[model samples]
Target: MTKSQPYTQADLAKLGNVLIYLVDRLGPISKTKALKLIYLVQEVSVKTYGLPFFNMPFLVWRLGPVAEDVFVDLSAEEPVLLANYIQRQEEDCKTFIHASQPFSDDEFSDNEMEILALVAKTYGSLSAERLVEVIHRPHSLWYQTARENGVLDYLEQGRMTTTNFEIDFGRLLDDMPERKRMYTGQLDYLEQSRALKV
Candidate 1:
């Protein structure tokens, strides 16, 4: 897909709802943390269910994997789509996003809601710094794409492609332990690449 392809209004609304759910469940989290949580939800959903979570492209942004249209909606000023659900606050030079209102689950499917809940349970308590470290692994899709082509589609390249996107856990049952460690930031990037022989 091209860089200019926009996420549908439904996708944007669902993302806002995801943000609201995360904040409500995990307490206030930084914008960076919220973005990473969303990315992880998409990543795991793709691998586990072989379905596109947002049906939108994400780029290897400097901060990590970022969905362009979602980024815009989240970054927009007051009166934006998320303004009604979330509020941004600055504390000690860091920006945090908190839920401004309760969010309903009407936008997501049962499986989609399950994925969001699983991700929140897994990574919601981690500090943003730890999340950043985990997501920026040199072996991650974002890092590999950014290394090949500079961040943000510098050469008009399409969305970042990941071999792990459709990985079959059943096929790798023997290696699941290692893979789990890698995803959880237990393995260093070099070690992960070496293990995978990438």
Candidate 2:
């Protein structure tokens, strides 16, 4: 969600584990959809826990937010972390990533596992088009980052640091309603935009 440090191998492994876990739950999914799921998990985790789940750097791409490192690895001939567990395929002319084997939840902490499960349950079923809409919501990290940087990579780790946000019970409770409205309004706007484009 925010500009974080480049991921280490272990981080990629943990992220790969989350990806595989989601693939198992949702079936083979498009790469774009997979990236959105990863972004959403990080976004929610950052807001709720004050620390991002994977510490992966994300950029504001034309499609929305993308973890370029993860994308490159998955597209590699032998993916760094997902080599044995994932396979890339083309179906109906669309690229998709499918799990080659079942995933184990051993690498993830209880909190990480909880967030992964929650994200998968809430968003795994959505189409990629819908995900882009949800992610571009007003006040979302993607929206803010894109507005500030245009299409450039998010390189402001200082601003994204947990220290920048003071998370308190009262603050969270107060912000929840506004966040809900932002999410709803963004979806409505996206639908209208899509209609206009069509």
Candidate 3:
């Protein structure tokens, strides 16, 4: 395996296209819902293909799994990464995202497209709040990570906090031994390559 490289502008563009595709399929959706849907896409891809769909890191946040960079970009007054691909509108005190252009599948494989469609069809109709509930269910990555980091207790006590914890995607492999082995080997190769580079 090659050393893991930093996410590039091209990668961001692809991510923006993914957002556009999801919005096109699901119609205008709130930022929260969009983030959850993206997380679901990653989850499905990792389980099915033994690899992540994208390079974005999903952190365990109070609302569930959040891709921090995407969250920041979406909330920016003048978005950089997705400026040409999407637009956000404010209505009824909610921020809803819309696709500003047509989606292109040139950057994604057939399996990736299938994962995106699957996540949209399965979770598209659910509200952001409902998606949060789903992600917070027992044994879910966000739930497990939050619990391990004591963030769950903080949240349960009605305490306002700024705790964001890294979620271990490796945990997604717990039930699939073959996939787990492959995933771990991939990780090992990436780490070894990184060390050699240094």
Q: Output the number of the lDDT-best candidate.
A: 3
Name the weakest run of 10 consecutive residues (lDDT summed) in model 1. 163-172
Q: What ranges in model 3 sit over 4 Å off?
A: 1-6, 185-198
lDDT against the true structure, per candidate, is 0.65, 0.65, 0.79
RMSD of 2: 13.2
- For all predicted structures, in order, the TM-scores are 0.69, 0.69, 0.87
1 or 3, greater by TM-score: 3
Q: Write the per-residue lDDT of candidate 3 for residues 85-106, one digit (tens) a residue.
A: 8999887988889988899888
Work out candidate 1's RMSD over C-alphas.
11.3
The total of clashing pairs for model 3 equals 0
Model 3: how far residue 197 lies from native, Å: 14
- Full-model lDDT, candidate 1: 0.65
Local accuracy of candidate 1 as per-residue lDDT tens digits, 48-96: 6645455545655656576655566556555275666788887787778
For candidate 2, the per-residue lDDT at 40 reads 85
